[model samples]
Target chain A: MIKIDQLSKVFQTSNQSIQAVDHIDLQINKGEIFGMIGYSGAGKSTFIRLINRLEEPSAGSVLIDDQDITKLSKRDLRISRQEIGMIFQHFNLLWSRTVRENIAFPLEIAGLSKTERSERVDQLIQLVGLTGREDAYPAQLSGGQKQRVGIARALANNPKVLLCDEATSALDPETTDSILSLLVDINEKLGLTIILITHEMHVIQKICHNVAVMEDGRIVEQGSVLDVFSHPKQPVTKKFVEQVMGKPDNEVADDIFIQQVNSGKVLKLQFIGESTNQAFISQVAKKYDVELNILQGNIKQTQAGAYGSLYIQVTGTDEVVSQAIAYMDSTSIEVEVVAND
Target chain B: MTDLFPNVDWPDLMIATGETFYMTIVALIGALILGLLLGLLLYLTSPGGLWQNKYIHIITATFVNVFRAIPFAILIFLLFPVTIFLFGTFRGTTPAIPALIVGTAPFYGRLVEIALREIDKGVVEAAQAMGAKTSTIIFKVLLKESIPALVSGLTVTSIALVGYTAIAGMIGAGGLGDYAYFYGFTRRNFDIVFVCTVLIVIIVFIFQFIGDWMTKRLDKR
Candidate 1:
């Protein structure tokens, strides 16, 4: 478990001071994948670096398994850092070293024997699925392959907490999915507590069990992936949620067909967890005397469960449509009347 | 060839060629080691570097710049006392080495710093995050990553050292430069001067070829 208490980082410049990471507290449980999502300059990068003391906090403590890393002496901090591995967005592998040598780097720092380093490096190569490219330099590998080497190198020391600083932001969509799945595999196989910062809601929706939305050096909101996806409170959170949930409400309202709805009403329906699995749209249409047309809908799966939204046009008597909206409200689905005449 | 250059003493020319080779190789080795150390210090003490000490950076930078600014001929005369103190004389190929190394190391040191600076800062940060010590980062990350640049820098520095050696020879140090001066130019034996120039050019080319080959072989990037 990692507990960050009132962590703050203020970068002092010649002219002024900038608070890159404001006072924030977060608790991540063991064997859980926690993600922090924010736009650029939202302090997500500094926040992750603060966990491993890569960016020293101005005030507060980072307790990993009950040990305050910030308080450790330089030598002791290095010793502690061995168990808190980190990977970067640019895949900061040593270009001069081959994959095998790169994976053995941390072990070499930890003073492992030559034979022991090789044995552990081989296992790590297989774990990250870079089995055959052990002798290849980082330049010889593709972007995904380079990240796999980064991941393998990070996991070489068997760290209890793995910190990823925008680890997948540089890869393409296909490679992103592969890397995310590999992270999930590492989390399950090793039970390592993984904390990653990213701007992509798809990343959070896919693998993060819990997510914290950051804005201007503070976490605006945080919750289970499903809950956050279904009900976003802050405007910033809503924008990130819309990344995977489809167009925003204002954009949907501006749709030509939605504007042409003279008599019918446009409703935005949100489905959470098992409710997404139910045929709520079909049942709602049948239960009420209404013709439902799904204008735009997106369903995404999260580690907690699946949550999605649909923008539908329902044509029926106003009373019956209101009743249908009330019915959806009574279920796990949340409904909003986007347009009504 | 013998008929064409009747004034040329074969044994004397051979000895001069040997002295030139001796001076270039020994001074190159000294300059490489000393310059690498100085360069590492300069780099590590610069702003945003690993050590990042202002005073140390200024001191090292001042030392390097001062040495680099001095002309090789004047530098030999300036270091005459120190050369005699070390070598017990200032009139042979061995004494000339001190001036050659001092003149060339600072120049090479600047190149080393530039080469090190070209490395990705992210790679250094990555090494630090891995619990690597300062020494480990220097050897494994900084130096290892900049091998090709270092080798090329050495190649340029070695060529400069060759030129400095000839300058050192102009005063009292014995080498092809001294031979060309005494027997070729002063005695009007232009053939000896031409022969010396050819040998020096050949030495420079050899260094260039070896440096380029090693750099290409080491650089996987």
Candidate 2:
């Protein structure tokens, strides 16, 4: 486990000192996919960079597996740095070195022999699925392929922790999905604890088991991926969720429900885990003797369990409306009434 | 014109050609090593390279500019008493070599600094993130990565050295330029001048060719 405690970083420009990373306290568990989502200047990148001591923290401690890395000596720091592999936003591969040599760089620094470095490089090349491009330079590879090499190189030492600072932000969507999957594979196969930081919530929605939402150098909200996505608390967290699910137009949704259920009523329902099945929707409709209209419903299975939110318009007598509410209350689902248009 | 072109002294021509090669090679080795080290210090100590100490940067930069501002001809003539004191002889090829070293070191140092500064910061960051020590980042990263630019800088330095060697003829440095000035111009034999000029051209071409080959071979992108 990696524990980041009250870490802050201040960069001094010509005019004044600017705090890039505010006091942030976070814990990333072992073998977990953790995501830090924020805007460009929200300091997610700096937070990622701090873990590897690429940028030193101005105020707090970063304990990697209970050892405070901020106190390591220069020589010990180099050794500690090898344990925390980092993939960059621009895919900072050495242009002069071949893909194989680039991947073998850290191994060489670790004082591995030539034959051993080559063997490790070969294994990494195959792991990243770039078997034949070993002799090729970074310029010859596409954006996605270059990132794969970045991944292969970061994992050269089988690091216990991998810090990916906007690692997939430059790639296309299809490429992003594949790279995320490969990261998931690496996490599972090597048991490497991964911290993926990006502005895209879809990236978090896809792979992150736990997530922290950052804004203006501070983490405003953080929890399980499923909890945060399904029931986002903060405005920033909701905005991040909206980025993935599109803006849930409460006004438009109310208008559509009122137009459809003008004679009766409509209510928004949230179901998590066992209550998310079609049977629950049917059970309430059957008990109330009403026709159910699920205008918008989204379901996603997370590391925890299945979680989803649904918007429904039920048409029946007033007596049945209360019965439907009472029926939904029997299960672990939150039901709320939408106002008439 | 026929009388001026006669008595070309072929053996003297061979000896002068050998001397030119000796001076260029030796001076080039000394200047390149010193200049490269000085250039690296300039690069690292500048505003944002690795070490950004303004006081150190200003001091070294001022020192380089001071030596670099002096014209090679005047510099050779000016450093005469000191040169004679050190080497016990100011007129010979061995003593003239130090004059050339002093003349070209700072010139090439600035060139090397420019080449090193041109290296992309991304490449350096990549090496550092890979657990490379500072020494490794210098030798294995910056030097290896900046080879193409370094080669091009060296080409510029050697060509400039060729020009400086021509100026060295005034001090009787016994190179092709000296032969051209003494036997060709002073003795009024145009053939020696023409042959020496041709040989200098060929040498410049050789350096250019080698520089071009090195750039093409090392350029990764």
Candidate 3:
């Protein structure tokens, strides 16, 4: 578990000061995947670095498992840092060291003996799925393999919290998915609290249980991933939600069905969780004698459950359409009539 | 062979070669340790370094620059008092070592600093994020990462040190330079000077070969 309180960082230049991270407070639960999504210069990187004091905070405190990290002395901070593992976007591996030696580096810092380090490193290599390439240098491996070494090295000490600063930003899409899955696997197996900052919404949608949308160094919105996806409140949050959801209204409006519809209503249906699995459209059509025309729809899976939106044109007598709308509104599905001609 | 170089003394030339080896090897070891420490200090105290201190950086930079700028010939005469204070005399190979180290350590220090600076900043941050102590980062990360550059830099410094030892020999330290200057050049024994030049060239070649081999072997990147 991690609790950040009023964390701030201001970089002073020769003639001006840049506030990289403003006063921000956040709480991340244990064994949960918490994601911070923001564009570049949104202070997400600085925010993550402040958690480990890699970038010393200008103000505020970070509490990890109830221990105030900001107040610790230098010696104590090093000891505490062993319990907080961090991985970088560049996979900052020691090129001079082999995979085995790189993974054993943190164990060496933690004062583990040779045998203990070897045994732990072997297990970690297996956990991250980097088995046969133990003797290879970082340059000899692919981008994904390099990131695996970075993960194996970070997890060597069995830290309580894993901080990932754009951990997969440098990887291709396929590699990024693999690394994200590995992070999920690690979180599940170790019950480690994961705090990752990324600009990709897919990463949050794939593995994160909770999502926070940041703007101008402030967290403008935070909630369960499903809630944020289904009902995005802030403009930035909506933009990110649209990253996965597509531009819904524009796409549906461009459809020929919506353009040619004369009578009846073009309804936009929002489905969340269990509603996506039900036969609401069929049931409404069968009961009310209305022709159901599904123009376009997108269904996506989140950590919580399924979330989707559908655009459908209902054509029938006015009385029957009203009855069908009333019947659908009674169910869990949300019905919005976009056009009534 | 005897007719070709009647003035050349075989035994004395061998002894002179041995003396050159002794001075170069000892001075090199001394410079390696001292320069490494100085370079680490310069790097660690530099801006955005692990221990960023403008004052320590400026002072160390000044010291390195001052010693590095002084000509090696003048450096020997300038360090005459230090040589005498340390060795109780300034007229032999051992006394020549003090000046040799003092003159070359700063030059080697600048090279070491450059080698350290060539290391990726992200790697150092990775080590620090791993909870490594400053000592561990210096020894394990910074030193280990820059071995190739450090070795190559040392090769250049060692070659320069060989030349410095010859200059020292011209003063009072007994080596091939002394043999060449006293027994060959000054005494009109061109054969002795020519042979000494050949031996020094061989020594330089050996150093360069070893340095290149080690650098190639150690550098995985």
Candidate 4:
């Protein structure tokens, strides 16, 4: 487990001091994937660097597995760092070394024997799915392959905590998906605690179990992936949710409701978990004798469960539409009237 | 022209060539070791460097600049006393070495600094995150990544040294240049001057060829 208490970082310039990270507290459990989402310069990168002591905190303590790492000596910090692996956005690899040598570097620092280093490097190469490219240099590899080498190198010492600084932002969307799945695979196989910082909502939606949305050096909102996606509380979180949702709430043209319904209504229906799979729309229509038109629908599977949202227009007798709305309210699905005039 | 080239001193030419090789080799080894060390110091002491020290950076930079600003011909004259103190002579192949080194080391030091500075900052950060000690970062990351640049810098230094070595012959250092001055130009032996110029050019070309080949072989990027 990693515990960050009131962690803050300040950069002192010639003219003035800038607070890159304000007072923030966070707790990440072992074997869980946590993500921090923010725009550029939101200080998410600084927050993550503080965990490994890459950037010294201006205030507060970082306790990993009950040890306050902020107070460790320089020598002790080096040893502690071996347990915390980090990957970067641009894939900061040694351009001169081959992939195998790059992965073997940390092991060499640990003073492992030649045979042991080679054996461990071989294992990591296989683990990251770069078995045959061990002898190739980073320059020869594609962006995705370079990141795989970076992942392999970071995991060389079997670290417990993996920090990814926009790890997939450099790759294409298809490559991003492949890397995300690989991250999930490693998280499950090794039970490694992953803390990734990204600006992309799809990245958080794809693999993160929990997410903290940051704005201007502060976390605006944080919760489980499914909870946040289904019911975003803050405006910033809502904006991010809209990024993956593909359209804002106001963008739902009123014509769809006006033209399809005369003296009818438009309502948003939210489904989570097993509710998403059930034919609730047909059931509600048949039971209440209402004609339903789904204007837009989106369903996605999160780490916790399935979350789906649909915008619909219902046209029928007033009594039947009211009965259908009342029936939806009484069930597991959440329904809200968008425009009820 | 026929009268000027009545008899060429082949044996004397060979000895002068040998003496030139001797002086260049000795000076090059000394300059390489000292210059590389000074360059590394300059790099580490600069602002935001790994071991930044304002005083060290200012002092080293001033010293390198002051020495580098002096022309080689005048520098040889200026270091006459120091040369005699170190080697007990200031008028032979042995003494010319000190002059050559003094001229070449600081010039090459800047080259080394430039080569090291060109390395990506991200590469160093990655090494640090991996728990590499400072010494390890220098040896395994900085130096390793900049090998091609460093080798090319050495090539430039060596070619420059060839020119400086010729100039060292002014103070009775018996090399090809001295032979050209005393026997070729002063004695009006145009053939000797032509032959010495050809040899120097060939030597410079050899260094360049080897440097280019090694750089290409070492660079994986």
Reference-based TM-score of each model = 0.92, 0.88, 0.92, 0.92
Across A124-171, the per-residue lDDT of candidate 2 in tens digits comes to 999989989989999999998999999998999888899898999999
In the range B1-221, model 4's lDDT, one tens digit per residue, is 44765646888888988888888878888888878888998999999899999999999888889989999999999999998899888878998998899898998889999999999988888888888899999999988999999899988988888888888886788788898888888888788898888888988898899999999999999
Q: Write model 3 residue lDDT over B151-219, tens digit each, in one string.
A: 999999999988998999999798889899999999998988998999999999999999999999999
Deviation (Å) of A109 in candidate 3: 1.6
Q: Per-residue lDDT tens digits of candidate 3, residues A1-341?
A: 78899999999999999999899999999999999999999999999999999999999989998999999999999999999999999999998999999999999999999999999999999999999999999989999999999999999999999999999999999999999999999998999999999999999998999999889988999999989988899998989988998885656666777778887799988778643654777778679889888877888877777788888889999989999998888877788988888
Docking class of 1: medium
The digit string of per-residue lDDT tens for model 1 on A189-301 reads 99999999999999998999999999999989998998788779999998888778777656766888777877788888776775365477789877999888888877777
Every prediction: chain A TM-score: 0.85, 0.85, 0.89, 0.88
Candidate 4 fnat reads 0.63
Best by DockQ: 3
Candidate 3 clashing pairs, residues 3+ apart or interchain = none
**Model 3 chain A weakest 10-residue run by lDDT:** A273-282
Residue ranges of candidate 1 with Cα displaced over 4 Å: A249-269, A275-295, A311-341
Residue pairs with backbone atoms closer than 3 Å in model 1 (clashes): none
- For candidate 3, give the DockQ: 0.78
All models: lDDT? 0.89, 0.84, 0.92, 0.88
Give the candidate number with the greatest lDDT. 3
**Comparing 1 and 3 by lDDT, which wins?**
3
